[model samples]
Target chain A: MSKTPLPDDKAMLDDIAAIVEKTGCERKNLIPVLQNIQDRFLYLSEDAIKILSGHFGLSSCEIYGVATFYNQFRFNPPGKHQVKICLGTACHVKGGDIILENFERKLKIKTGHTTEDREFSIDKVACIGCCALAPAVVIDEKTHAHMTPTKIEGIFLGYEIEKEMKIREEKKRDDKDTPA
Target chain B: MMIIISVDDKEIQAEEGTSLLKVCLDNGIYIPNLCYMEGMETPPSSCRLCFVDIDGEKNPVPSCSVKVREGMKVFTNTPRVRGLQWSAFELIMSNHRIDCGSCLSRKACPLIKISRHLKIRLKPFRVGHINSGNEDIVEDHPCLIYDITKCVRCGKCLHICEKIHGRLYLTFAGRGVDMGISFFGDSDDETIPCARCLACVKICPVSALLSYERYEHSPEGSSS
Candidate 1:
């Protein structure tokens, strides 16, 4: 629930402990336990690994190893908006690299890093299997097919409007709650 | 009872359920192998160098995983087997640093031995070398100087650690091209003392894992 993954988070620790209890502690459950943690926190936190190591009676390094072995595992908390640009053969030929550079330049963050505001994160995937949509960019799991550098500005505008609406709705609800 | 198996048209007698790779090796047959050790119930099968063609199988299978059966006909050097092995070896070589002259295990290097046996060049000709991320080899571990560039992703070091310590202290982290390994000197409570056993250094085929003390004194260490 917390964006910053502190190992001392009591609520997160309890949830992780509950996950271990529900999943059972056989070595076979290692992946499932990790998956559950990742599902809950959107990433594999260091504290989660330590909890697993303590519960499973295994070393933390070994737990970390299994977690890192799979591509599905994420060690960093994802930003609010995750951008995955495809760099497969078709996409690469269609200026996927240029699109990635545009995103990095706009966000002021390098690839594989979250923006300082934690609003956006950039990642380059081998392929999204949408070769027909060459230079595909997926933001927040919504695939934007045939993306261009100029197109990124329009997409950001859309997200900004969405964020603005959500904030306004939250403010209105807060105002109503205060009985004014 | 000894079971009879025909390998390369030569009949060999071996115990039932013996690993085909071990059976072949025991009877003076050589198979280019790595990541295999005696008494291992399940070999890592990661190196994938020990491939053999058995009759009735459409594709070449790793010999280390195959158990010798009665009346089984096996071919060790068929074009298919060699082709698969060559590609696998080449892939491994692509990841390898191949600077054998500067390597500590030059004398006992298994890569050189495999290359000679396979009649393939140590340098990969098919698949170009992959840059293994970091060019700088910096290790903070007290006991070992782990050169990431030379590691072949073999689980020998991890296996040996598990066998020796009754738990996996060393582990291969990450997967695919970015995978790396780690070693813990002790457990959380510091109950188990590793004491620089150096088993990993000895077990490594290409000397990816080296003793820090030895590495410090070596010409390679002084220069680095």
Candidate 2:
């Protein structure tokens, strides 16, 4: 995957401003405003919160408290691939903890943390409503059922291989365009 | 309008639509409460300590959230009410890392008072403690020390801060069982507003929020 440069402060402010223009600056519409921000940027940026605070006539702390009260928002910049391990009641019964530990060990990052390269982030869900699958691990958008420690390694390796292949394909196209 | 309500067989007269807990406490009937403050338009029923069984209602309701009504029959110390109050108290204490001797508010801690009144231990034997998995103390604020373990999520500090400064600097962070106050300011913040407004430190029921010097002058650290 190609690495995109971080959005500049001006661009981020403009995006937030556009969202505020549609949602207005009312205090009551904070959830919708935050949701829109979350959808635009996977996680709420500090600049976005500050811009929203100014637009809504609210203090930064006040907006921050609201954003945190609901667990929906995350302040960290999201990684490209999100690995969600379901630790639901059924999943837990069927060795979900082991599966989670395996992922954490393999990634060299604990749950709710992203790798330094911003490629993978691990998250544990209370439930994904797939109890029949028991121990389920969802990477990006696809769910893998009955995940074991060996299976988790294989899956992550596959992701890395796919990523490498995509990079190689992009390099080939670039070479063709430049006519070397 | 004034309304007469019977609380634990005592006839008490209070303003209608006011908090039942306030009415009972005003009339020398003590019902344990944490979040309720005088003159709050809406009481955040976060603490869940002031449970009173009303005659008509099937379940015990938090007295702080209940409005005083005319001819209302309320039982604060009934077996059912006591059971529910104790449960709530234990629930709050379950997450609370209780250490009385080291606490800054040891002399005036509400948890101690509630435990004495409710006959429940500070570290409850009934419910196993739920680890928050966060640091015991957060010293990130420029001028304050937040003890995450001691915080009961009572919202008293939040209320008082909102009243004094039009909003809270130490607002809630996280959600569900992991929820607690999050001081949004950086440790290196030059313009620390909380230094002037120690309202949160003064208002906290469990002494979760304290001034920077509170540790040095803590009961164990200094002579009183």
Candidate 3:
């Protein structure tokens, strides 16, 4: 536990408070409230849920039940990059499971889990509605079609390089802003 | 208005739009199910055991979610339906703990009855079990005991809570493979106690939810 408060924690709380105010704290607004919270936070944190429960006068259990029933909601904080492997009917027939297994092995993390460094997280989606591109994987909103086990290593290597470049660029900008 | 539907070649007169599952059970036709509550408007259709082949449909459908129609033909014992039901049963039981010898709800457990009806033996260690991380029996509440390892995620308890209390205290937490029921709020608070209705326990298809007192004095405890 760091003594310094996270800069974003207050902003996140303000956003949550605004959403709750807009939703009017009704029992029926639970789903939409969750959707909004997830949209803001990238996932539902325990803190956010506890706040929502307080506003709605519902127990944590009730809120959790609704969240678990649906496949869309995520509890853990999302990685910087999201990797979704389509496991739809078309993809499944075209060896999507093998591709997914390959990703899991390479990332050293199971589906729905972020890497230890929090760089990437993987999820198995029912479909992206792109059946033509069987065995598809979407990384940070970019679709990679006709994926295979061999292609996964190269794809991850590309992301790693991209991350390094971004970090270098950010460091250069920070140095330029500092006094001589 | 009454409409006639043929279930297993026996023509039964049922009301229009009534659930085929309700009709079958009313007529002494057993279709195994775990998620269908009597008054629930929108059925969860989670349990795939009630699969039945209707005339003109290529694949079997869950009978609980299907409404009976006039001149409709339903085949309850078709090969495809049995195959789907068996696979669903096996999949559900794969994650379930099968320690019936020491379990409290042995005599009344619906999973046991359904398995026996399907003639499938309980093979505990055949498939890998889901580690829900809720293996410890929750004894926080004096009346209710929850052993999440035995839970089937049937949604029965959640629905019953809503029906009885107008709001649910128990709810599902997590998603996909990690999903399980969790109690909300402080369990020690006496104002919102579990109602002690036992509706959830009575409705549980497995022994996941048990009465703390009954569990202590269960059949297995006598010899021990």
Tell me the docking grade of candidate 2: acceptable
Docking class of 3: acceptable
Question: Which 10 consecutive residues of model 3 chain A have the lowest summed lDDT?
Answer: A1-10
Model 3: how far is B19 from its true place, Å?
Answer: 0.8
lDDT of 3 at A119: 80
- Which residue pairs collide, candidate 3? A61-B184, A65-B172
lDDT of 2 by residue, B1-224 (tens): 98798987888889999888888888999889888898888888877788889999999888887888899999988898888888898898899887776777777888889999998888878888988767677877778888888888888887887788776577787778778788763334555577777888888878888887876688743653
RMSD of each: 5.3, 4.4, 7.6
Backbone clashes for every candidate come to: 0, 0, 2
CA displacement after TM-score superposition, residue B180 of candidate 2 (Å):
1.4
- Which model is ahead, 2 or 3, in terms of TM-score? 2
Model 2 residue B89 distance off true place after TM-score fit, in angstroms: 1.4
Model 3 over residues B1-224: C-alpha lDDT tens digits? 89999999998999999999999999999898989988779899998889999999989999999998999999998888888878888878876878888887768888888888787776533455656544457666657777767788899998998888887777777666567767744465465656457788777777788776667787643554
Q: What is the C-alpha lDDT of each candidate?
A: 0.82, 0.82, 0.81
Clash pairs of candidate 2?
A: none
TM-score of each: 0.77, 0.83, 0.64
Look at candidate 2 and tell me the lDDT of residue B135: 69
Grade the docking of candidate 1.
acceptable
